[model samples]
Target: MALPAPTTAPTTAERIRSACARAGGAMLAVEGLEPAPTPVHHLLDDGSFATTVPVDSALAATAVSAGAAGVHAVLELTDHAPLPLREPVRSLVWIQGRLRDVPMREVPALLDLVAAAEPNPALLQVNSGITDSGTTTEPEIRYALLRLEIESIVVADSTGAESVPLSALLGADPDPFCAMESCWLQHMESAHRDVVDRLASRLPMTLRRGRVRPLGLDRYGVQLRVEGDDGDHDVRLSFAKPVDDVTGLSQAIRVLMGCPFLNGLRARGV
Candidate 1:
């Protein structure tokens, strides 16, 4: 089915934020340095991003000096899919701003916020002196909390590249399905060829002959990529109603596939 274009443009802020939240880590590069991309743990909240760097690192020194000199150092934070996929990169967010050192007194509160939102085990290492393997010892990794005061934000993805206003980014929320999308899509592609074929029946007659593959899923609907002889086409199979949770989403999928009764059965097993 051909879905109507949205009345307004899709904001990249939501996608960028979603990617960052799920990624947990990002490739951070400081401007004027030889592309020394370092893996930094990041958390995004309140229109800004907080990252941790080793106190003795060169990057930390550079950022502190730049912030003291009143120079806004351009920093780039790139987030991608953690799972193995054909196209791993979900989105890229370029942040332009001045980096300031977060005070030692405030680091615990900030870490608490991150732990509450993400609950990543890495945060436990930052908070308690325990590693993933449950080993406790002296603090081996001393980190300095740095806050990037976002001046400008730019995002790039399959749709295209665009700059997102900081206000919009702060106001927007990530897609409900962002965390589960990869696992669900990968499962559909690998284990459920029959189900995919059945869902393809909803495609328009003219385009049904093309190779239809599951492209993506969101709160609004499912997307299928049709690779035809001429070119590729994207068709959206919107649900009968908006879904906010997994139960509603399952019912919506069953309705879309013309098998409302399938809810009782083990659909995932199929």
Candidate 2:
């Protein structure tokens, strides 16, 4: 069946933020340097993000010198799908901004903020614990915290590419289901062939015969990719109502399947 046009386009800010959070890591590109992969610790509500690298690394040195030179070096952060799929890259969020070294005096406060948002073991490893003799062990690896002062954000995805305004990005929040989406999708594809078949029945009669696979799932709906003889078609099965919690999501799926009794069975597996 031809997919119905969406009443409102999905917000680019939310999608970009969620994609970055889900990927956790991104390929950071700076001019005159090879792109380096770094773990993203937090996406601040201010439309900026924070990452850390070795203090002695080339990237850190370049950023420090660039700031001194009054040259605002552009940095691009590219995030990809964590799971293997027909199309591995779900979206890319490029931040055109100036990279600056976080001052030593502010390091502790910044780390505290990052930990409050999303803590990583690596953050803890930055410093060694105090010994019984009241002496602190020096850290083996020293890290330099850097912040990207966002000038602009460009997000590219299946729908299309658009530049999101800073105000919009700061105002929007990532989708609630993002963190668990990969696990849910992988589980549906691997162990629930029968459930997938049932979902296919909801498609248009003409397209029901195609190989139907669970393409993705979000709070708004479930998506299926139909690999047909003609080509591929993506169909989105929206929930009867938007769901915010796991219990509501379960009921939404059952409603979509037109079989309320199947809720108990699906619950056990999901």
Candidate 3:
């Protein structure tokens, strides 16, 4: 007989892409070099990644040597809750691929693609020509843009681990609320304990024994992490249906809490 299915609403591919988009930290590991600290990066829609490293750093030198053959590398991305909850990490995405430097001629176009997805200031600092002392000078290359051509992607979280196909990952879109989820969840945890209690009430009696905290939120539902003596339990309080906008999310959340008077989330904050 087949085993029971896991929650099917957010497919593995969707979860991988969404987690990558919202990842708070990233580390790149090449064959011989130590894991480089790469906090800012972007996962392009094409299932590849774009990141930067100091032009004079060892990693940049390694990439330059790799050239066309490309170096075997793994990029690990981590998604953590904004709140200081126990077991803060929500998910991990590992991309095993070939890493190479983006040709200087193509750097401009690659930056454009990365900027469109996530305009990190670090990217600007690379081409800004401003020295570490903040003095203006001729445009200088302070960083080297690198690309990871993905070979495979695997995502692991409370749910489990799964290998996602490149096509599926390319086709998937990040959660609509991914960028804002941290703020909203932070607001709920700090200001709306009553609402969280109400939502926790929906869980089974056994699960109610733990310390419940907001774990994550998506367009489909709110996730709560119950930290008990045995371990942590992640429960998804799904919306009656998938919601598209903040108004719908607010209504769905209110309905789940059985509190109709709850206010809507603001554009900038909750």
Candidate 4:
């Protein structure tokens, strides 16, 4: 017997994506554009991998334009707890969930903004640690692969061998490359991945993981999550405004890349 269709509204991510938002701001952030990323190369000389960093697409022209238009709305990921009073109405908010620290520099600002914007801030059990340079460099590298959209490239190695050859190890380029992102981006990326992975597993229904790359803040609708699902899926609607230009958005993102926070709930286990 076919069960009657469930009557509840679609999840926030869903609603905005078409189950809510619309085509221009669907489940994806950088639709038909590019992905943000960094890369690491395993030197033939040594087993160690060196990073060739690419920038994030969330800071892309599309994202910036959407954000500025106030179309970039996000839904706070909360576990149905009592929310703070000063909820944000702009375009973003703090989701209540077991937040994996993404290590943004202006974390305090983001949190303050969320506190001001969101109402019922609940919590969820999610990956609590964080993503730093060492962990998610590959994703950034993936962004670099696009080649067309990418403007600059930064290659860094904690081992410091990429710039300073493992052999010579001296008198290498004294200054860092133009493409380099501060260490903080790595940490924030880690947080981004953890949430993405968990959501892929947790959502009652979702399009596909490969299509989406939760870049953070969707037109003030879904917080900490962005969908870019591929194949057979309606472009998830994102009620976000554009970032005007990717370069400016990327610059602003650079500023917010490692903000810290005191999450209300600290889950016991993974």
Which model, 2 or 3, shows the larger TM-score? 3
lDDT of 1 by residue, 217-244 (tens): 7777887777788766667788766678
Cα lDDT of candidate 3 equals: 0.83
Arranged by lDDT, best first: 3, 2, 1, 4
lDDT of 1 at 60: 71
| Candidate 2 lDDT score at position 180 | 90
Q: Which TM-score value belongs to model 1?
A: 0.74
Report the number of the highest-TM-score candidate: 3
What lDDT does each candidate get?
0.67, 0.72, 0.83, 0.26
Residue-wise C-alpha lDDT for candidate 4, range 1-270, written one tens digit per residue: 997753322223222122111111111223344432222111112212111122344433343344323222211211110112122111221211110112335334433433352221210101112355446322212211111121111222111211112333111211111112223224435555554454334333555543333322322122223233332222222222323343533433333332132233334672
User: Each candidate: RMSD to true structure?
Assistant: 5.4, 4.8, 5.3, 24.5
Per-prediction TM-score: 0.74, 0.82, 0.87, 0.18
lDDT of 3 at 156: 87
Model 4 worst lDDT run, 10 consecutive residues: 19-28
Clashing pairs in 2: none
**TM-score leaderboard ranking:** 3, 2, 1, 4
Candidate 3 Cα deviation (angstroms), residue 26: 0.6
